[model samples]
Target: MSGDDAQQHIYKTHGLLLNPIMCGVCGWQFYTLGIYNAHQWMQYGERPHAFRCHAQYL
Candidate 1:
């Protein structure tokens, strides 16, 4: 690939920092999506969601 192609790919990548918590009491990082999914489902139910913010990612 060309240098320009590499640069564009880097710029297009999306990143997110996840801070996991139990019952919104503690802020800890959940290493993987599987862990996060398990925690959310067990704690809040099948479709658990964050209640703190109203913004939804499109």
Candidate 2:
């Protein structure tokens, strides 16, 4: 994971939406579904089933 890769991954992870996504567990809001998913992947990646939510339009 180079710096660029990390940044790109983060950007992709956070899709930059005008309306952010809310965490089902923590109730924290993120810029996009990708951000929430990335958070889950980083925070709960080791756990089975973890957590997830899809973008309503995407």
User: Which residue window of length 10 is worst by lDDT in model 1?
Assistant: 14-23
TM-score for each model = 0.34, 0.39
lDDT tens string, model 2, 9-32?
665676465455676767888875
Q: Which stretches in model 1 have alpha-carbon errors above 4 Å? A: 1-26, 47-58
Q: Please report the TM-score between candidate 2 and the true structure.
A: 0.39
C-alpha displacement of 9 in model 2, angstroms? Answer: 18
Point out the worst 10-residue segment of candidate 2 by lDDT: 49-58
The deviation in Å at residue 34 for candidate 2 is 3.0
| RMSD to native, candidate 2 | 11.3
lDDT of 2: 0.56
Question: RMSD to native for every prediction?
Answer: 10.3, 11.3
Strongest candidate by TM-score: 2
Clashes (backbone N, CA, C under 3 Å), per candidate, total 0, 2
